[model samples]
Target chain A: MTSYVSDMRRRRLLAGGAAVAGLAACGLWATAARAQASLAMPQPDSAEADRIAAEFTGGAEPLAEGLALDLPALGDNPAAVPVRVHVTEPMTEASWCEEIILIADLNPKPLACRFRFTAATGSADVAVRLRLIQSMPIRAYARMNDGRLLAVRQEITVAAGGCGL
Target chain B: MARPPRIWISNETPAPGEVVRVRAQVVHVMESGFRVDAEGQPIPEDLLTGFTAMLDDALLMEWLPETAISQNPYIEFTFAARHSGRLRMVWSDGSGVADEAEREIRVG
Candidate 1:
């Protein structure tokens, strides 16, 4: 009878240990998931370029081609980097480029500038000077009148003091 | 004090059914508010936030600039060329400071 009682107590203790270990494993998994979620958020010195594009495109994923992003691969000065964008397609009253959104992935604010055009804005080609904070990929999203989001990306290296200001 | 804006057109007088490029520049520091002074004080933002180009009576294009634009911003765009009466450009800042210029566009 005493052996039977001792065996019961040992079994209970073993079960309790097993429960504790399972709880520990659950805790580990929860912590790991939280860490991964945090990592998935925007990284430092980076912008969620895709997310911004989607917002502008009314939640439609942008087509990754069709825009001509003209800029220097290496920028000797971040203060004034020349950038030009040309939409190769024809512009018409029925269909035209409505706007162009310029995004600097590493800038404090990703949406750098927006150029709005109409059918009378012939060619849909525009150029401007940009101020980049660092070396990073930049994107130009063109929103067409027909509800298409056209995108192009370019990577640039700043050669001097960062243009943070 | 803000300086006057300067504007140039690739061709003021173009043949019918032609496209002309328009270049506009406004002189300003385009000071971004994110900077810190030598004493680690935040600088105030001063920028030309809006630019509009009009060909005669129609709006050709508009540019919305932010802190990421360089000082003395140079913007270039294109418009359908004709014997437009005028090409007008207006540059404005956030706090109501504005400057504008107009050029007569005549076809031969």
Candidate 2:
């Protein structure tokens, strides 16, 4: 009887181990499938950024200058990363910065925020907090009242990820 | 009704034409809806969707924020002090709930 009990216990353990291994393999396969889907999606690239910009500017190529974006090279806390954007152009009624658009490349929602300004605004400078999902480039696009687009980009590495599953 | 928010200004009193920084923050969960609870249930999205600053009657700056913003959202911006008036700020969430606070500033 004792020998039979021991044999049954061993069989149960082996069956449990096999089940665990099968579950792990299933998990890996699911992960790989998700990764493949992500690859098929729009990636964080300048072309994607351009497409977003064109959506706002009607196919106008944003000038890669005239916007100063301040962000830390390494983000220790991805939850609340401070960001500052300053438009170089003057804030006048005739030639003022109309809006400022922020984009987080790796975020599920690439368009972070859009800040609108009027002539009454003293300056085209803004400071805000952002959440990053991974290490990627953050871009700022400033639109002038004259329909000109100015942009700047910066890359940041997040020690801890945020805004991601 | 949402709770009142906290607002801070770098300088309450500034010389005419001087630039002053204004910062405002609110207490909120800012749940992104992408996270799951301990029970594995998905959390619903709740975020501050809009922020607007006004001096007297003129609009100073307005922001359309997103889920990328962290919890207890905070924003700062600078504007030239042109005259003495009240600076009013409002933050609105996706549910249409809004909280507002104002600060009295003087421009000499």
Candidate 3:
């Protein structure tokens, strides 16, 4: 049978689509047409992580401080690597982390997951496992309730690639 | 049916103004949908879509899990110790199947 989605197109769509899929629900576009729209998004290049984060910050650059992302200097496993994102700023009614986005630049699907927080969460400190595809920089952006955004990036070296697939 | 999950808080009983760490984990395939079977056909996506931590009626945190999350996903976070209540960790899949684990948090 002839292929409807070419292999290269399928690969590119899978890369960009899954990333957008994670954001789709939050973006409020889960309809059937949204799937096609996300798949039609531009192909991810080397700067994929930055572009994804921009969607959340609304072009406002995140500060380098008040946030820290913890991952190993070297991740031996591409399948389940540990990660921790902590908002250094105090969490109070006046200020707290509103949302968090984790991006693995080298992965086929760059946007891994997003976390939404409230004052009840205390410090906005979270830890989870992620699949890393290659030895590259992992970026995290945190949206604060005080109209400020914080971000941190760490160079995580994984042994092999393709774990995200 | 699946087995229950594990939830651990560093200090369940803490004085007011104290913060405690929480760790929770569950079992799931977390299928990425990128893998193909013997016929080289893509596998349909099936994975937990959301995880939540709640204390009584208050929502502490929520995580949206994607295919990049590992099998048998695990997560950890921290919360302030306030009034005593039941702390619950809930995990839900795309089909709206919600599974949860709970613990009594006695804040002094």
Q: List pairs with backbone clashes in candidate 3.
A: none
Candidate 1 RMSD to the real structure: 18.8
lDDT of 3 at B107: 84
- Estimate, for each residue in B9-92, the C-alpha lDDT of model 1 and write its tens digit: 888888775788888888877877766554566667888899998888778899999878899989999876755668888888
List the candidates' TM-scores in order.
0.79, 0.78, 0.81
Q: What DockQ do you compute for every candidate structure?
A: 0.26, 0.33, 0.33
lDDT of 1 at A82: 93
- Per-residue lDDT for A1-165 in model 1, tens only? 999999998998877776677866545445443211111111265437667777888787778887899989788888889999978887776789999999888776777899999877766889988887777888899999888889898898887765646
Q: After superposition, how far is residue A41 of candidate 2 from its true place, in Å?
A: 11
Give candidate 3 regions above 4 Å deviation. A1-44, A161-164
Candidate No. with top TM-score: 3
- Candidate 3 is graded, for docking, as acceptable
**TM-score result, candidate 3:** 0.81
Better of 2 and 3 by lDDT: 3
What lDDT is reached at residue B66 by model 1? Answer: 85
lDDT of 3 by residue, B1-108 (tens): 756787788988888868889988888878777666545566677788999888899998999987668888888888887778999888999878557888998988
Which residue segments of model 2 deviate by more than 4 Å?
Answer: A1-49, A161-165, B1-4
